[model samples]
Target: KIFEGNGAIAVKLFPSNVNVTTTLALASGKIPWVEIYADPLLNRNVHEIEVESEASKICIKVENLPHPDNPKTSYLAGLSVIQLLKQLSGGTNIVVGT
Candidate 1:
């Protein structure tokens, strides 16, 4: 089954699940249109994002595996946090992406 609603409402209801939307909003300085789906057929967490601007149009889709120790969390999310920490700590001078 799939459920659709406002991302703001979703943030309040499913804080952890919809956190990416919140991060997107903060990064873009705009509240993005969000669609939440509950599909039992999917084994991994999938996120799709579309952005259009006068300069360019962007589309991204990512499917992340669940953490081995925690099914509720995406493994990539934890890795991303670790990477951020390493960057912040000045461990590396090479920054790949913005």
Candidate 2:
């Protein structure tokens, strides 16, 4: 079954980074309505997700910190890219996680 209605949510965050929305799109397999905010008082990036489906209603919140070595990127995002590259290079016999 798939969600079959128009849904809306407001995504607010610092304009400097919006990768979380991209990540969420990938996870949910759909592009979501997004709104960005540049908050000077925030020391960390924040994301909130809300989903309403026939079977369930789900909400998620995440706070992210910049990579220690690279301030422009999230540490986990960088690692995920590297992990994908490793998988594509066929260096390992076992692949883990979706």
**In candidate 1, how many Å is residue 2 off?**
4.6
Q: lDDT per residue, candidate 1, 1-79, as tens digits? A: 2446666777877788888889898998877677888888898999998889899999999899999988889999889
Q: Model 2 off-target regions past 4 Å?
A: 1-16, 23-31, 92-98
- The per-prediction tally of clashing pairs is 0, 0
* Candidate 2: residue 64 Cα off by (Å): 1.6
Enumerate residue pairs that collide in model 1. none
Query: Stretches of candidate 1 above 4 Å error?
Result: 1-3, 88-98
lDDT of 2 by residue, 1-98 (tens): 11222223332333345556666677898877664555778766676778889999999987778789986677777788888888888886554697
TM-score (C-alpha) between model 1 and the true structure:
0.77
